[model samples]
Target: MTTDELKGLKVASLVDARGTACPGPLLAAKKAMGDIESGEILEVYSSDEGTKVDIPKWCQKMGHDYLGVVEESSYVRMFLKKS
Candidate 1:
């Protein structure tokens, strides 16, 4: 989806892993996913460039829906729906 579309979405959780490295953001997202219920959305914020690819791959492997991402000035907001 477009960044604007993602901005309008209501996520169940928001995990800010900005300023960290590759595995850091991914790990944060995995932990945060546990707090939300099935079918709920999880929004992850990260400045790590790898997250653009990592998050989608993680979602695919974990059986979740990879919605899309929204890029901000310094960070990107990634959306996923727990399955």
Candidate 2:
């Protein structure tokens, strides 16, 4: 998918993966993204430490855009733009 595919996309929902373990956050992100429009953003919140690397890597592998992260003391939220 091209960058244009991800343009004009607003957020659809947030997937909360707090307290979950490896791959859970990514899995939750997938489920959330499935409910959204093709160009929408799916925000994922996770307490898993792997998310710092996993989220962006998953996006790259799937042709999505990693919008960046929002960090809270308890969790990290990642934004992904579907492409």
Which candidate's TM-score is highest?
A: 1
Per-candidate count of clashing residue pairs (backbone under 3 Å): 0, 0
lDDT of 1 at 13: 96
Output the TM-score of candidate 1: 0.96
What's each prediction's TM-score? 0.96, 0.84
lDDT of 1 by residue, 1-83 (tens): 88788889988999999999979999999999999999999999999999999999999999999999988999999999999
lDDT of candidate model 1 versus the reference: 0.94
Q: Give candidate 1's total backbone clashes.
A: 0
**Sliding window of 10 residues with minimal summed lDDT for model 2:** 1-10
Mark the regions of model 1 whose C-alpha exceeds 4 Å error after superposition. Answer: none
User: Candidate 2 at 43: error in angstroms?
Assistant: 0.6
lDDT of 2 by residue, 13-52 (tens): 8788999998788888888888888777887889998888
Candidate 1, run of 10 with poorest lDDT: 1-10
